[model samples]
Target: MSSTPANPPTALHEVWLIRHGETQWSLSGQHTGSTDIALTDHGRAQARALAPRLATQSFDAVWSSPMARAIETCELAGLGGQRVIVQDLHEWDYGIYEGRTTPEIRASVPGWSVWDSPVPKGESLLQIQARAEAVVARLLAASGRVAIFSHAHFLRALAGCWMGGAAALGAHLYLDTASISLLGFDHESRAIRRWNS
Candidate 1:
C-alpha cells in the first residue's frame, strides 16, 4: 500500500460576539441576570445602528441568549431570522444580587465585587466558565462564521475562554451595551480580533 499525506489544517473561522443593547437596569449599572428585562428605546436605536455593519457580514449561524434584551437586539440588528436561541448564552445568574447596582451591593457588603466576591445563591465563576467553554466548542465545530448575541458578563467570560484564560480574566475586559466584538484565530493562535466596537 502506498503512504498517504496528512490532511491540511482547516482555516479558522471568526465568531462575532455582540453584547445586547441597553436595558433600564443596565443603564442604571445593575447586575441583571435572569430578570427577562426588555431593551430601552435608546437601546433599540443603538441596536438598529448595528444593522448596517452586520449586514455586510455573512454568518453561517447566529445564536442568542434567551433573554428578551438579547433577542430583541438580534432582531433590531436585522438578524432575527437567523437567530437560534441558546440557553448557554444567557447572562450570569445574579440570584440575590439581581437588579442591584454595584454601589448598593457595596453598601451592604463593603468592598464587594462580582469578580472578587461570591454571589450568594447564584451561579459560580466556574459554572459561567463552563458555559462559555461549551459555547466556544460548539461554535468551533460549526462551519463558517458565527454570531452570538448575549450579555456583557457572559460575553466577557466567553472572550476569556476563547483566549485560553480563566473566567476571572473577564474582569479585565469591559463590554458596553450594543457593542460588537470579534474572536478569531491568528495563524493558529486564538486572538481577539476586535473588542467593544
Candidate 2:
C-alpha cells in the first residue's frame, strides 16, 4: 500500500491555525466533532476580533472545514474570498458521543480520557492523523503562508503530527475559540511556533 506523504520540503512558510469561536457545546466543554453546529452570538464577536489581528498578514491560501462553525469563522474573520473547504480539515468524528462531554462519558467508563479511551465508534488517533497528514501534504506541494480554520482536537492533532510527534500528543495542546496559532519551520526542521494561548 502507498503510504501517506509527509509535509513539504519548502522553506517554512507561516501557517496560521485557528480554532473556531464559542459554541453552546464548546462553552459547556462538550466533545465537538462532525456536528454541524453554529457559533453563539458571542462567538461571532470573537471571530470578528480576528479581522484586525489578521488584516496586516497576507495569506497565500485559506482553508476551512465545511462545518458551519469553522466556515463562519473564516467569513467573520474576513477571509471568505480566499477560503476553500477541505474535508481533511473536519473535526474529529465523535461518533456515539457526538455532542457529549468528557464528564458524561466518564460516568460509564471511569477516567475515560480520549487519549486513553476509544471514542466508541469515532475516528481513532491514527485515523485522525491520516486526515492531518493529507492536509499537510497539500500544503507541502505549494510554497506560501496558509491559514487553516478548524476545530480544537483536529488542530491539536495537526500540531502534533507536524512536529513528528505521535497523534496522542494532541492531548497535550489546548486551544480556545478563535484563538490563532503559528506553525512554521525552525532552521532545517518543521516545528510548532506556538501552541494554544
Candidate 3:
C-alpha cells in the first residue's frame, strides 16, 4: 500500500465572490463607485435569500467591501461576524463619473468606456488590478474556502485577476447584482467553477 501525502499537490480550494444586493443605482444602470448607497427592498430580500445557499458551507475566512451595500449584504448572508472589511475590495472609484449612467457619459464623451476610457481624478485600471491581485493573493493563501462580498465591477476584476488576466478583461464578465461566482483550481489550473449564479 502506498502512503498518502498529508497535503496533496492537487488539493483545491474555492473562493466565493458575491456581488452586493441591488441598489437604486444598480437598477438604474448608473455607475456606482465610492459613493455609498443602500440596497433596495428587493435587494434586501435578495441578500436574505443567500443565507440558505451559504448555510451549509464552511468558510475559513469571510471578507466584505467597506461600502454599506456590501457590508449589509454580508450581514444579511449570515457572515457578518466572520467578515473582515477590506478597503481594497471597494468598487472602482469613478470620480467625476460617479452616479452617472453609461449613456450619460457617452453623451459627453463619445465611445467612452469605463474599461477603456480614463476617469478624471479616479482610480486607474492598474490601481484596480493591483487591488484585485492583492485580494486574490490573500484568498489563494487561505487554508480553506473563503467568501467575499463586494461590488459588481470589483468582483469582475477579482475574477479576472484570479484567472491571471488583466483587470480590463473584467468588462467581458457581466455580473448581476446579488449574484455568486466561484473560483477554484481545476486540476492545478485556475478556473471559474461558477459564474453569475
- Judged by lDDT relative to the true structure, which candidate is superior, 1 or 2? 1
Q: lDDT values of the candidates?
A: 0.87, 0.85, 0.86
> Which pairs in model 2 have colliding backbones?
none
Estimate, for each residue in 75-154, the C-alpha lDDT of model 1 and write its tens digit.
99999999999999999998799999999989989998777688989998989989998887776667678899999999
Off by over 4 Å in 1: 1-11
Q: How big is the positional error of residue 2 in model 3, measured in Å on the Cα after superposition?
A: 29
Give a tens-digit lDDT track for model 2, residues 101-168.
98898898899877757877898888988888777777767567899999999998888777774667
Query: Which residue pairs show backbone clashes in model 3?
Result: none
lDDT, candidate 3, at 49: 96
How would you encode candidate 3's per-residue C-alpha lDDT over 66-156 as one tens digit per residue?
9999999999989998999999999999989999999999999999988888999898889999999888666655557889999988898
What's the number of clashes in each of the models? 0, 0, 0
lDDT leader: 1
